[model samples]
Target: MKQDVQPLIVNVKRYTLVRNLVFGWLTVVLFAGFLLNFPKINILEHTARNLYFHVPMWFTMMAAAFVSGYHSLKVLQTGDPLRDIRALQAARIGTFFGILGLSTGIVWSRFTWYVGTDVWWNFDPRQIMVSIQLLIYGGYFVLRSAFDEPNRRAKISAVFNLFAMTALPFLLYVIPRQMESLHPGAEGNPAFSQITHPVMRLVFYPAIIGFIGLFWVLYTQRVRVAWLKYRVTQDSEM
Candidate 1:
């Protein structure tokens, strides 16, 4: 059977509308994040604004990881090349967002909890686990490169993607909360809900929506490009 490209092609007009909406929505989120008056916590006063970007980025990465895994599962079920393309691109974009989240977190922690101390990485459990999670995803991409046959690469990569996705919850959330850490909701710690104002949720929720939207637009564009490249080159590795 011929592998049809119909499922891989995105609707141009729909893509444009969503792309524009994400752009506008995130623009508002950017301005509002900086401009809005947040209730002051003694230590976190101004840097609390990092909440809008940092937390939502992890949300986006989590969203992207699942999206990738879902497609990877489909790839396993049906052996669709398009699904493999999507899985790879989603993981790529998700990894980028994860890096941003991690970097922003380091900065956020330095100025707040580690202030006046030279500690950049204090082995916070969440931080360490999340870092390990990213490295696992990194191994997925490396695993993909090991095979030249498209079908073999797709199947193997799908398996690895599922593994990484499975690890995410434990590494990012469950294990972190079980350990002593600087993060909110750690063992014997106050969760964000207990520490911060309800007002922050107004921006927080929308920021999640906006960043996830941004991830979708970027993911769609990459899938389209990879589809085209596969058509021309008979390879979907991009």
Candidate 2:
């Protein structure tokens, strides 16, 4: 007799209330901090409100990319095709959040630049490289779907994902510092200003945590859905 394997369940029911309580408390603290301290920033003033959404978007993007790279590494080591699918979903979702982050940052820029002071888009190397990073993953999805052979798709994507992960550090940190820009922390900029404010920290930290948690939830769901579909297709073929 053949043994039946159970599908994975991606839930933590025992800690449901605890997680909710923590998330609620953090959300309240972030909102309160933002309400109280937002006026102090001269650059954006009221427009600084974008920080709540903008920063969180970036955090989620990083989380997604990290998850993608992790699964890619696992697939390479273990030769598990499911891990490759999970990694692809992470890249797809992460890119969505990255684009959202870029859009929100641009809106904030427009408010600060005060119209006509600069172009709508700049040729900054960081921006250009990050955009290319986005396209690289976009092509990844297309390439994966183009092949009917699971083994070939997984191997090719794993190699490409490893290469793409290297660009992340450059795009997120290094290249930004090399150029002049309207964005903060540019051109050898060093300031404790953003990180040191207690009120801002209250909001920023939770926002980061909340966004990361949210990404995990979404990624888990995507994997479950894809796994189910894969099982169904296999059954029908049999």
Those runs of model 1 whose alpha carbons end farther than 4 Å from true positions after fitting are: 1-8
Instruction: Report lDDT (CA) for all predictions.
Output: 0.93, 0.71
Clashing pairs in 2: none
User: Lowest summed-lDDT stretch of 10 residues in model 2?
Assistant: 229-238
lDDT of 2 at 86: 81
**TM-score for each candidate, following the candidate numbering:** 0.96, 0.84
lDDT of 2 by residue, 46-67 (tens): 6665666787887788778888
lDDT of 2 at 64: 88
Please give the lDDT score for candidate 1: 0.93
User: What would the per-residue lDDT of candidate 1 be over residues 213-232, giving only the tens digit for each residue?
Assistant: 99999999999999999989
